[model samples]
Target: MSKRTAILQTAAANTDAATEALDLALAMASMDQSVQLILASEAVNCISDNPSKRYAMLELLEAEPILVFTDEPLSNPHQLDIEIISSQQLAPQLNSYNEVLQFS
Candidate 1:
């Protein structure tokens, strides 16, 4: 199984970056790689979006590549994981992944 890690940090004001991160996450899912999406700082706004980009993010997560979104530290969920986490938690979480990508 391939492991992918992405940290999405787009505050409410940075919708463009946030949307781009979501798109990237979706693409990663299409590649069939397990993904962990970390939303930190103002990027938490990405999570709060109505309908939650969480669902759209999962659409790309379907099948062989599992996708999860979290801002916090926790076990990986099968479908998708959304959490409120810290930078400290992100470091260790990312270290476990085969590849790590960051989006500001």
Candidate 2:
């Protein structure tokens, strides 16, 4: 199996950039690749705000990527993989991925 991983970080309000990146990640991960999402700043809101419209958009994707947070709480049941990570610790863990995608 071909294995790949991507790290996406976003800190936007509309979240258009993050959403697009997630769609791309889902497409990539659907092909047996591993994927992870890094939430920071304002983007972290998406993970903890109970159920939002975008949450469904993310969950509907075929590939379920792991969700990593920095100073963010993990409370969503739909989140397949969730963890709290520090900004300093993020880089080393991110290095393991074959691919890394960052967005603002």
Number of the top-ranking candidate, with TM-score as the measure: 2
Give all TM-scores, in the order shown. 0.60, 0.68
lDDT of 1: 0.53
Per-residue lDDT of 3-104 in model 2, one digit per residue for the tens?
556656675635677677666666665554566666666667666665345445444554554456565445666564456777777778778777778877
- Which lDDT value does model 1 have at 70? 50
Candidate 1 lDDT by residue in tens digits, 5-99: 65444445357776666666667677875655556666554434443545445644662222223544444333244444455565676677777
Query: Worst ten-residue run, lDDT, model 2?
Result: 50-59
Residue ranges of candidate 1 with Cα displaced over 4 Å: 11-14, 49-60, 63-81, 86-88
RMSD of each: 5.4, 3.2
lDDT of each: 0.53, 0.62
